[model samples]
Target: MSEFAFEVALCALLERERDEIIARQLGASVHGRRIMDIVCVEPGPDFAKRVAITPHEIPDAAIESRAGVGQARYYRNCFDMHPDRARSVAERAIEIGFFERVRQGSRLYVRQTARYPDEWFGKLVGIENKPDLAVPGDLELQLRKDVSLGVFDEVILATESYVTGAHLNRIPDEVGVWRFRPETGGLEVVREPTALDPAASGVDIVDEYAGRTDMRVATAAEKARLRRRMAERAYGKGWRSFDLPPCVHGAAKTVSGADGIPYCEWKESVVNPAEECGPACPGYEPADPPEIDIEAVRDRRTPWVANPKGPRTQSGLDRFL
Candidate 1:
């Protein structure tokens, strides 16, 4: 399979526990409304026909007049709903990137929140009525019409590593990628940089479980992660969720298995190692060995000839000189 071009981002999961916290307070689910396998399709042209995942809305009361899963949790942990809670779940949500806390004039402010940012976060393109905001939380989340959950759609691969190894070919302009998290959870945004960039932010998780991006590396590191992930697959247990190296062989150093035989060893000797390859391979980034000397090379009248014993000139008497 070839790499499919698609924009990518993330939407935080809503508290969708299937139980009630208090008899009076309850919680809501991000995917609560639809029981089907729904792939949230975004309204295009950047605006219009945007849909909201209605389940994120704050319900009037628990399903049975008690705090449902969401209501109880938020209230118990100090949700804005119950100003008398022991802790504030809303504050924690903002701290953990669940929602944003913006100031509204006076005490009456609008909520710019979403259960899953992708579920209900977007431009108000085609929304007919203003949804009621009853979920009492520090940050009030609102609904939108133009945008949708970011899945395999808004991703970008800066590094060619994914393209080189996989049978997948990524078509251009497929997914919209973002370098930073969105303010309103408008699109799916991850904390980690795409594997195409050498930046090492662990937040580089896939937009979803099935989605994946490369772990950007300096060839050797990439090889390492590839081997680790591949080992899981070779064992017939783990699914191949991450990207692999390119078509080049021998460029990767295959670690030996306990069987006394190496898997995929031929790929290394057959492929060319990149210049940035590390100790696992011959290539490496230039690191100053030591502040030995500009004067050492300049002062020496003759280059120290290489001897198996040590680096020195051939002349026995000249050694001191």
Candidate 2:
């Protein structure tokens, strides 16, 4: 199976089996360019509170700003970033119902609709998918980076190849291994992962050369911020992030109870619409995209809420403006 197809199948299976929020191809590193294949965000005590806030991602800048629920602060004073960036962040926050804004004279003041939930998500499990382990491109290095960073609670490597001692020895001991079959939707744990300490400071491998390697130290606080940002993004952006192709043969295929998978009839399997479907293909025929309500499917199948009532009312300043 292609990596994209394998990833979608695994995500579908995981969504059906686990209650955690599943997201695909997310930036998981704090200061490095590490993109995780799949991320599983387990809900914490305040998961419901997060769901009540908004169905979209609350801007990290807005969340990190000085704005609070009890008192409104000068919009510009709330953020440490540039004035233009701050204004943009505040606008997004207000639009998403996470913040309420009011204009006083020519200045704008803002406050959180509700206090940001610190414990909205629990352990984050980062999964790396390499269906064919024979062509393991940067697999060992990526797993090493994840282990050293300790950003994820547990790191796992998922593949379709048969396990061998040589393959296991190449990766870190802390990392777990999973043999998954996309055809049968079967997952076998080859090696259990050791829990990493997210509260401790971590070392990020910045770059590597023939002789020397550059590195940066990430504080626990930094990791915490990244974790929050990642979880919020996962909550807003689920695994079904792809668009269905606008080809006659393209359709939404149901796999493991999760709908909205981009399946091509001509290919007779899951396909990466962005790369595979186009006028270049011989099977291509112009047609309206399939009417698949991905959001409704997510609402019905997952704990995520859609079009939820805002937790707080706006300040009613729009009418005056």
Candidate 3:
């Protein structure tokens, strides 16, 4: 079906109720605006009986169901209802912030922050916000402007890497001396061990590591880009139980089926940290190596991922079959 056709089908399916299902599917994209709720485009002849929506303004949908592919009714509703548009109905999905093109990656991940509520993110996968890592923006805007507070009093410190131009460190604690610049909107935390205070216990600044100090500053856009990239990196997954996805760099073994066809290994998790299943499947066991002919495995995968926006579905289907 065309994107518009699928959207109309989805709307018809959700005409009465189905928001919980919608929220369940499209909730985790972090970096850009995704259609969390139905955006009712301006009504027209094509939208007569349905609740037409354009998820994040992408021609494709923000959510799909494993129950069935291209099954519009099975997946519908905004998982992250934009606060500004929280009160809106399915008919007005647009006008909240539907940029046609997003600069970030495929998925939209909500920024991990203490301020994010369970209602907004439904209990994020990881509670910790990577310590004091900051998104690219004006960190210390001086809420009062005139009522200056000590740089040490600031709750979080956001900075850049001295060598890699990457997000390497977050101090997250007490340091003896620090500086904040109003003109450049930058922060510097210093740990000189001279005058013997709380952090000066070892007092080995000049004696131990003299030139070990490092500093870095990155532009706001650069920091935002960095955070976006980090969010996409899959990590800390419990390999067993089939409840979590494997790391992007992880390798999984494949095998041939009775029909002599090889298939790539794939697993889906409904819960988390799945319990060890014992001798049979062994919850965390590495996938089995392919039992198929070597040439069969080599010839299976297409050069690229299947693109829905691409044309010639009939030819594509034949290649896979």
What CA RMSD would you report for each candidate? 26.9, 5.3, 23.2
Which candidate has the highest TM-score of all?
2
Tens digits of per-residue lDDT, candidate 2, 70-160, equal 8788999999989999999999999999999877889899999888888879999999999999993899889989999999999999999
Candidate 3 on 212-310: residue-level lDDT in tens?
A: 522233334433332222221110111010222233312323211112211222333221222322233334455443233422322233111112232
> Against the true structure, what is each candidate's TM-score?
0.16, 0.95, 0.17
Candidate 2 clashes: the total is 0
Query: For residue 138, what is the lDDT in candidate 2?
Result: 90
The parts of candidate 2 lying over 4 Å away from their true place are: 312-321
Q: How much does candidate 3 score in TM-score? A: 0.17
lDDT of 3 at 229: 24
Poorest stretch of ten by lDDT in candidate 3: 232-241
Instruction: Write the residue-wise lDDT of candidate 1 on 1-321 in tens digits.
Output: 011111111111110111100010011112211111112222222111011211111221211122222322323322234553222444443343333444444331122233322121111111111111222421111111001211112222221121221212222233222222212323232122221221221222212223543221123343223222222121111111112222222222211110111112333222222222235643333332222232232113112111212112224323223
